[model samples]
Target: MFFDKSHLVALGGNMPSAKGESVETLRAALDRIASSGCELLAVSRFYRTPCFPPGAGPDYVNAAARIACDAAPEAVLNLLHRVEAEFGRERVKRWGQRTLDLDLIGAGDAVLPDAATYQAWHDLAPDAQQSEAPDRLILPHPRMHERAFVLVPLADVAPEWRHPVLGRTVVEMRDALPDDALSEVVAL
Candidate 1:
């Protein structure tokens, strides 16, 4: 499962970087990602999303991508982190505004770590989610189901991709969010 070719990625950025605006930064990051042995397939249209934590920072430009990378989940995660770093991403804050963010949503139907670990992080309380961070990597991104910024764009590229644990499709997850939340994730 880790080596599954259908690798889903969620790309985002808020702050300006060496590449200029978020969209420009993300586009460059996508190219970097594709060149790193991962074949970039389809990419979702860019969307403008409200920054999380309210006034924590400016809004973000987000998008999702589908790729074919024959690599282990951890290796893929490391690759993503490395890409983020290349664009000046810092691990200073948990959920902090960043110059680049590349999240490995999932690899095909892989359930990282294990179902139990995934569930533990999935069920993590909202307050805890803001302050706490997992020391290890979790697959399908524990909160992908709840973030319109993530799912709305994901639906664009991998609408039919089902969550390995929740058994829900990306479109289904996106539709389940409140209308107000969905409204915040507007197409750019």
Candidate 2:
């Protein structure tokens, strides 16, 4: 059997929403995504990941889901945003605690805009990254390789999914992280 996980979603939240709290919000978001004419092939176990910057707020419930969708990447992103809004998410902060977050991690190994554009965001310095948000979507998620929160759960559902730009499987990226980084994402 062959598994293709090019279309993926990363979910996270640390606050309450119309649906309920972090775990509930994320679960509801998964259902919402499946309702959008897409197939929810698999989902990782929910995880407890510490807030970035250490102590920004409560820990977040994070997970990854593999989906199959025919829509364009931009449309898919819009759908994810709409689902987030339905869960009472507000885009007021760069990376603040949220009621829900649905990220279109990637779609079919396709590079958006171009490889160069993706590279610019991917190479951003940690300080510059804090204040700068890309005006457009950058996929295979620019920072995916460095984030255990994303890679750990992604490995659960799509360990074989390869990064189009980096040419590494999800499991490889997740495994390459330091023990401390991996330790931060604890399965719930």
Q: What lDDT would candidate 2 get against the real structure? A: 0.88
What lDDT does the true structure give each of the candidates? 0.92, 0.88
If scored against the real structure, what TM-score would every candidate get?
0.97, 0.95
Model 1 misplacement above 4 A: none
Model 2: residues with Cα > 4 Å off, grouped in runs = 1-6
Q: How many residue pairs clash in each candidate?
A: 0, 0
Worst 10-residue lDDT window for candidate 2 reads: 1-10
Task: Judge candidate 1 against the unseen true structure and give its global Cα lDDT, from 0 to 1.
Answer: 0.92
Q: Residues 106-140, candidate 2: write the lDDT tens digits.
A: 78778877899999999999999989998888887
> Alpha carbon lDDT of residue 103, candidate 2?
90
Candidate 1, 1-188: lDDT as tens digits = 33577789999999999999999999999999888999888999999998987888999999999988877878888999999999999999988999999999988888878999999999999889989988888997999998999999999999999998999999999999999999999998
